[model samples]
Target: MDSITQLHATTPEKLTEAILDGVRKEINDLKKEFQPKEPDEFLTRKDTAELLKISLVCLHDWCNKGIIKPYKLGNRTYFSRKELVDNVFNSNL
Candidate 1:
């Protein structure tokens, strides 16, 4: 006969600590993923704006019009550096 410890009763302090620890771990994992393990060209909207010397609004508009497509994930949009470079350098701009 074995007695089981019931973890269904969670103290507020313990719950908070557990939540914070989980969040911290998630943040650390996100940081690692964002650190770029290789030479990649994924750029955020801000990066695209700076690279193209264009406004965020303009970029969003262009993306919407399909002039320059954007990759969306959840709520974030990404642009490829190669595409921007090709557009800027290869074009008559």
Candidate 2:
């Protein structure tokens, strides 16, 4: 059930201020609920290998076998830190 409350003898300025306050509160609540995502951190092949305690050859093998994914930029390869962490947690090895 919806109940309505009537405002009696409210001035224009007071009504405007009340409406503005409600809007401001709603905006603040929305801001509180919003979260900004951090950009993914990219690592070079050598850096990724070192982070995983693996050799460059092993890293290349993993990439070839699709065990780990790589991103290419021009002629260079890169790995994402988030993806690495996720893979490590999701996989047995």
Candidate 3:
């Protein structure tokens, strides 16, 4: 029931560029909508990866070693945006 599922077989090679461009545009729009008045102060694994410019493996290792603690929600995990920003700004990494 994916809306864009039809794009796979019907789309031309050039359609990939167009599709990607549209997707990027939508993501940028969403980002603007989520811009916090202050700060998010929390983020997901993918968000942490983007902020740290590191792979999930490295983050996982740090979590295991207790270098940084994660906020667990049931089986899910996440990092604090404040913690990451503070660490980066303080040159902890």
Candidate 4:
């Protein structure tokens, strides 16, 4: 059983508070379940270059040198923003 299910309160105020708290928690859980998660975003070469504050040539050089991984689909190449953030920030730690 959930914590809310096991709740036992003597005073009316305490009982009311517990019920309200349980309802609130159930609403929050439903909201979390129904809410659509963000899709994985892929940045274009130009977008990635601008994000990194580097020139397009430099970005390509990094990709070629295997410094940063690239995702290629047909004629297009892309980079993951999440991976970039993790790589840049996690390296400092």
Instruction: Please write out the lDDT profile of model 2 over residues 2-80, one tens digit for every residue.
Output: 9998789998899999999999999999988886877999999999999999999999999999999999999999999
RMSD (CA, angstroms), candidate 1: 13.8
Say which prediction, candidate 2 or candidate 3, comes out ahead on TM-score.
2
What 10-residue stretch in candidate 1 is worst by lDDT? Answer: 84-93
lDDT of 3 by residue, 1-93 (tens): 656545445658678788999999999999999887885577788888877888999989879988677999988888888776666557755
lDDT of each: 0.86, 0.94, 0.80, 0.86
Top candidate by TM-score = 4
Estimate TM-scores for all models: 0.53, 0.63, 0.51, 0.65
Using lDDT as the measure, which candidate wins? 2
Tens-digit lDDT string for candidate 4 (1-93): 655545454778888888999999999999999999777789999999998899999998988887788999999999988888877546752
Judging by TM-score, tell me the better candidate of 1 and 3.
1
- Candidate 2 collision pairs: none
Indicate the TM-score of model 1: 0.53
Off by over 4 Å in 1: 1-39
Query: What lDDT score is found at residue 18 in candidate 3?
Result: 82
**Each candidate's root-mean-square deviation in Å?**
13.8, 6.4, 16.0, 5.8
